[model samples]
Target: DYHLLGGGDSKEVYVGWNHVQQIEIAWNQIVYYEDDEKLFTEEATLLKSLNHERIIKCCHYWFDSESKILNTITELFSSGSLKKYIHNGVGVDLVSIKNWGRQILQGLCFLHSQSPKIIHRDIKCDNVFVASDGKQFGLAVCIMDGDFVKEKEPKCTPEFMAPMCLLEMVTGEYPYMKCSNQMHIFKKVYTGVKPVSLGNVKDYRVRDIIEKCILPMSVRPSAEELLKDPFFLYNGRSSTFETCAPVDNILTSRAMNIKHLYLV
Candidate 1:
């Protein structure tokens, strides 16, 4: 067995490559495309199309017959997944997390705005990769497993799940009943400890967006909804997403009662 260096998800390992004889269907796909289907090929091509300092690049892909597995040969790096970094005595540095979050959101916005929105369905720390070096200045993580899809019988993770998603699993649970505010989220992240405290928050617009993202009672924003705002923009250049959150116009009147949860 070869010891591959890497990080993992439910379908992958902490580090390394797995060989398969053919393509294993993505666990979350509603159904695999027919033999002549081009969805997978199309996505691979799209991944190849995007390149940015903060985006995770798709290195290569191949299918094996004997083992029945398809593989993506990615650019190997010394840094691991964001989860590892957080676990190894790494506190979430606000600025770094902000940069990483902005890049990812920009990627997501691009994906969602496409003909058919590509729901990351699964987004969390582990699915994000850390930059190879410290000098990158930005946390520079990218959307890993970008080509993944759901199966007829899909499985999901709970930890990073939007609560409404928890309900979709047929495990009836109560949704959050209150309107969430920014401080409410700080409490969750702080988790019983003193608040990390914000400094010069107005100076970091990228951060304000992320803080909006992790709010416990907050609902996930749609690419369309973001576009409706004069703030969030697709300027066609720059790494960080642009925003002007007219505080009154930015935060939507959704979440807490999270309506639609699962994509599949």
Candidate 2:
């Protein structure tokens, strides 16, 4: 029997066991809005085409004509999402960071290596799953991600949501927390001004990589190129967990210095 897992604005997730396959699966039931049917269909098609170890596998999907729901069955991860770990106070040392970062880049490399080159617009901690080995190792699986929506007015919510959510949810503040609204976020991003969270990263190598990721798409390094970066090659490890300040503390300390400069 299917049981509720979680849900969002337009979709509800459920967990169920496939009797024939003898495996648990995540059931993503999306409500297909008539106005955005094409977009939904495109997303479904893209999901179907993806198959990689680093990527979450969508075993099957079907549209229910009567209910107007698009149902997709994907392999389930018992360990839940990466977001859970971050929120639960898991100590993220340099070694863990390198391994996780490399795995994420590997998933991105696979998507980018495709003929048309797919871009996962939304690469947040929530969308990334973790498969734990019951000890110290976890494998990351990136779902076909990105939530960029286009309309008459440029919407900056989804564009900034990933970084904002990752930091704000865990630390109670994000880089541009001083910004009052989406328009302010838009201006900050447009001017190539990065969030202060990047500077808070303890390791220089990791910080540099994070900065590179936010560079303009024209100059941003491809996932394949990022995979070869020295951070992954270097074997040296450090105890970042103990030294790094809690995200909230770091942001709060800088709060007085950060001005909500809205130049419009």
What would the per-residue lDDT of candidate 2 be over residues 41-88, giving only the tens digit for each residue? 666666667788788887788778677677888888777766565655
Predicted candidate 1 versus true structure: per-residue lDDT over 1-264, tens digit per residue: 334342333123223443563321111111222451354455555555555554555555544445434455444434654544444554333344434445555655665554454445444444555566742311222223322324432233322333122111111111221216544543443352212222223335433453444344346465355444333543322332222111211110111101112443
TM-score list, all predictions? 0.47, 0.77
lDDT of each: 0.37, 0.57
Clashing residue pairs in candidate 2 are 122-146
- Backbone clash count for every predicted candidate, in the order shown: 20, 1
Cα RMSD for predicted model 1: 12.9
Worst 10-residue lDDT window, candidate 2: 252-261
Q: Which candidate is the best by TM-score?
A: 2
What lDDT is obtained when candidate 2 is compared to the true structure? 0.57
For candidate 1, the per-residue lDDT at 7 reads 34
